[model samples]
Target: MTLSVHWRLDPAAEPRRSEPGAWQRLPALARDRRVSTQNRFDYFLQVAQAAAQTAFDGLFVRHRIEADESRIIAAIIARAVPHIHVVPEFPASVGSAVYAAKQATTFQRAAHDRLGWAIAPDAEPAGREAQADFVSDGDLAQRLDEFLTVARGVHRERPFSFKGSYFEVENGGFDAPLNRASFPRVYLQGSGDAALALSGRHADMHLFAPASTEALAKDIARLNALADGRSVAAGLIQPLLVRDERQTAERDARDRPLAPGTLVASYDEAAEILAGFAAIGITELVLEATPTLEEAYRIGQHLLPRLRALTSAARQAA
Candidate 1:
């Protein structure tokens, strides 16, 4: 069984300073503030690309960016991964439209075949009054159409031409046709009708937030109902902290603190969760590596194998 690993970049993993002239008691102290944005970007790109270049079959990146900072971040991402996924900040609102549009340009025009977007279902007018933004089934279907239309238009024409109630792309379409991939592969999150409907119509993958086994199973049924003939996939991402060596020093130094949070219990809980999703037809899982790079390495080296075995055993029993 092949398991796709979605490795995320950790800020703390970055080098603090350059070690000059080898192991001297006083290494060259490069001012931390002197690190250029491009330098940081290149460093992160190296980490992300190095991880991707490994044996993982596919990769998904979780990127965070400020509204104005998006272009630079997107450019960095385009340089790092062959195919990139830009997950726009969620609780997605009209405010985010312009930011999303601009970020989409970097990938849509240059990396369409290796790019995709994960959009959340838009909320409804009724819920708007309550500040609920609870997207209904109909709302999801309509929004799916709007989202895809805008995305395609942006990728095809340099000047934005799409005009929708939620967003309008102006002077913003791709100058050249999208290579290979016609439309960006979309992923959506949520359990509501609107979310499910959107997934059926537009999303290639559905990301399930922390949920119980039964709840996830029911969601799979709901999603499959709408997805008819198209190939629809599902994945789960759970925060984890892994430590294989578990030495006293390493244990104390780990960022997750192991005593609290679900980090420690995540191993078994995640196993059960993966089993549940697999039973219900969910195909992929993106395990959130712990905060410390050491812990992440441990998880990749040790924990992943156990999970792999569990999946194989479950499959054989079925």
Candidate 2:
């Protein structure tokens, strides 16, 4: 299987410190006063251009309450960098399914089918309240299921009708050019049974949190079983820090503990480790690093080539 590598595009500036809650205390007004909108969009464009130039397959624009809206940013970036995919993470609870599908359909036509939908569960209660999304924890999965069902239904077929526990639509769908546009690839994230089941039914890809290779393999197996014959690609979202030398990598790891499931190593070692992950059925990887722009060039120039070579060799042997 071909490996697709995507760089994480976080609109917020890198934090000064990694301590918990360090970045959350500042008010939105305080942060906005520091940077202009044009500058922020410039930064995003530069990152997207770098990722596209570096041979990466896509950019995964992360969702943040404090930052610019993900869908807007994704649309702009996709327009700026037409070669690579731009997958935006948005909560399913944010808007109506039909409306979201209409927006996605327009995006797909404009971007030439490079848009991806990374559907996120509603995690922030206050944000949910602000948006008037009253979906409770118990009904989150059901709501997501109905959301995708209706969204896909309207996008693909005309005169679609659906009545679910959470959503109801009668003869609702697109027409002509709108219906002709391709649907965005759906990506679902989570490790729970409900998450897996939802992905099995709707998602083209299932994203897992960073975990050990063994744990990821087992989870992929479970997802495949849940899919029950449909092909759903397995993916991992992990932080990576690679250096030219082993000692430098070790020191960097000690100095900056980014997150769990982080891979810190020299270029060669990282290639070997990541190649092992591909061998075990990880077809896609979303890797984040500090100062993402520079890291995009770093991984794209050094590590990705090595990993690609290894994966290619393995595939040939198989």
Candidate 3:
């Protein structure tokens, strides 16, 4: 299978969108007068547009604690890049499943089949509990099961209700008939046995963070074995830094002022390393590029073609 690539977007962290005076400070926008509220938004849109024009198969927009990242950009990404899949990482507990399904369906109406979802079981993917005063330490696996069931149930376009440990719906369905394209492709990220089992049941893709090659191989095998024959795609999401020379990339990546644990190597080395992971079942890569837009364009314009060429050559030689 071909490699499926995805780019990450952090509305809260990228310099262009995060700095208070970023709009006036940007080289291109140095003289522009934009409102404070819309400044970050415009910058975010610009980066999103740049990403959409890249060779990436889709995007993975994170959901943060205070900021509703998914909601803030889901509509914009859908309309802006209606061709590629726009996947918003959503917290499983944020809203009721029925409501989420309806909301997603409404979004698909505007963007067609460009809709997809990634579920972060915790309020934060870092395993931090939500800030709610009433509820904490909820059953993540149970919530996921019920959430997916309800989310998929309503999309059948028939009035449906569900009774599960975490959710309840009564003859609930979308007001308008759901488009067949509204049934979203679901992706889940987890490393534990329980989480893998949960994903084996529902997720179309299982997103993994970078780990030692040996440990990751075992996890991949376990995930597939647990799936009981379900075809689940394996993926990785990691920081990417690529350049022409190995030494230059190493020196530059290790010295990057903004990030920790960055990948510093030529695109060829990165592709070769990734091919090892791919051999063990990882077929997708979600790259978190530093300096966001500028670096994203750098990779898209320069590294992607070279990486593809190297991989194709290696495949032919094999």
Candidate 4:
């Protein structure tokens, strides 16, 4: 399982495609843009195993979590495979601009398992209390101080400490080292100047919504510029509003009329759509479901197979 497919679990009711009496129309809504959306709690363990059993390689659980919770989730995922990413949160709402800032300030005090001053007194692999990273706003020096402080506890090899507007720390060390020498890649999703800068400096991966290939290429290049040659990777998870069959992708993109610009109309169209993303340096794409679970199932069961076949043929020919 080399390719990874992560489900962005934002639990919001979009307007359905009908009337109030029949089936209401569903509008565009992404509650969290994090993987902790509802229904997933029930199916996550199963889904994780399923993905591991199948061709997909890893799992990334979203939501800002306590260290204990993070460790528990990581351990659960490690049983099947060792790669799991814990996303703190996604600023899905434009109105809540300070949401991340507030969360960052309290990050170290959330809970035993949360990113905070305290962690579970006793966690497996031992000494888990030292991984909390402080979050704040207003000053870059402060934020970097906070980051360095937390990175030291989590890293501990060359203990880190700093004093600045947002944070201050000294001689921090981890209670227990990471199971893996280095941390797994962290992921972020947003399109803001601050968010982009933070991801470029710290995040291992970044996600984006669907966009034209040319547009997406520019976006990736912008992010790369922020990275300053750091080894961060990028991914795109476009909505799969089409089918592998050329007719399906075309028909769906043109006629389905579920979400405007949601479908691609045909497989060839879908391929062309994806080629644009790949060209933009997107490493992975999570083709989303249409409007309902049934539609999602149809894609997983039907469209995926055909697309996979077509992709295989093209690869061989190339």
**Can you give the TM-score per candidate against the true fold?**
0.63, 0.90, 0.87, 0.56
lDDT (Cα, tens digit) per residue for candidate 2, span 1-318: 899999998877563323233434567566533322234566788889999998999999988777789999999998888789999999888678999999999998999999999986577667777778777778888889999999999998779999999788899899979988899999999877778888899999999998888998999999999997789999988789999998898897888657777888999998998888899999999988987888899988999999899999999999
Q: What lDDT would each prediction earn against the true structure?
A: 0.55, 0.87, 0.75, 0.45
Error of 1 at 72 (Å): 4.5
Q: Across residues 70-120, which tens digit of lDDT does each residue of candidate 4 receive? A: 433443444434343223332221112122233332332232122311111
C-alpha RMSD (angstroms) for model 3: 3.3
Best by TM-score: 2
CA RMSD for every model? 7.1, 5.4, 3.3, 11.8
- Per-model tally of clashing residue pairs: 11, 0, 0, 26
lDDT of 3 by residue, 152-234 (tens): 88778467888987899888766555645557788999888888988899898998877767978998999999998899888
**lDDT of model 4, residue 315:** 57
Best by lDDT: 2
List residue ranges in candidate 2 displaced over 4 A: 15-37, 124-127
Candidate 3 has its poorest 10 consecutive residues by lDDT at: 125-134
Query: Model 4 residue 203 lDDT?
Result: 65
Give the range where candidate 2 is weakest over 10 consecutive residues by summed lDDT. Answer: 15-24
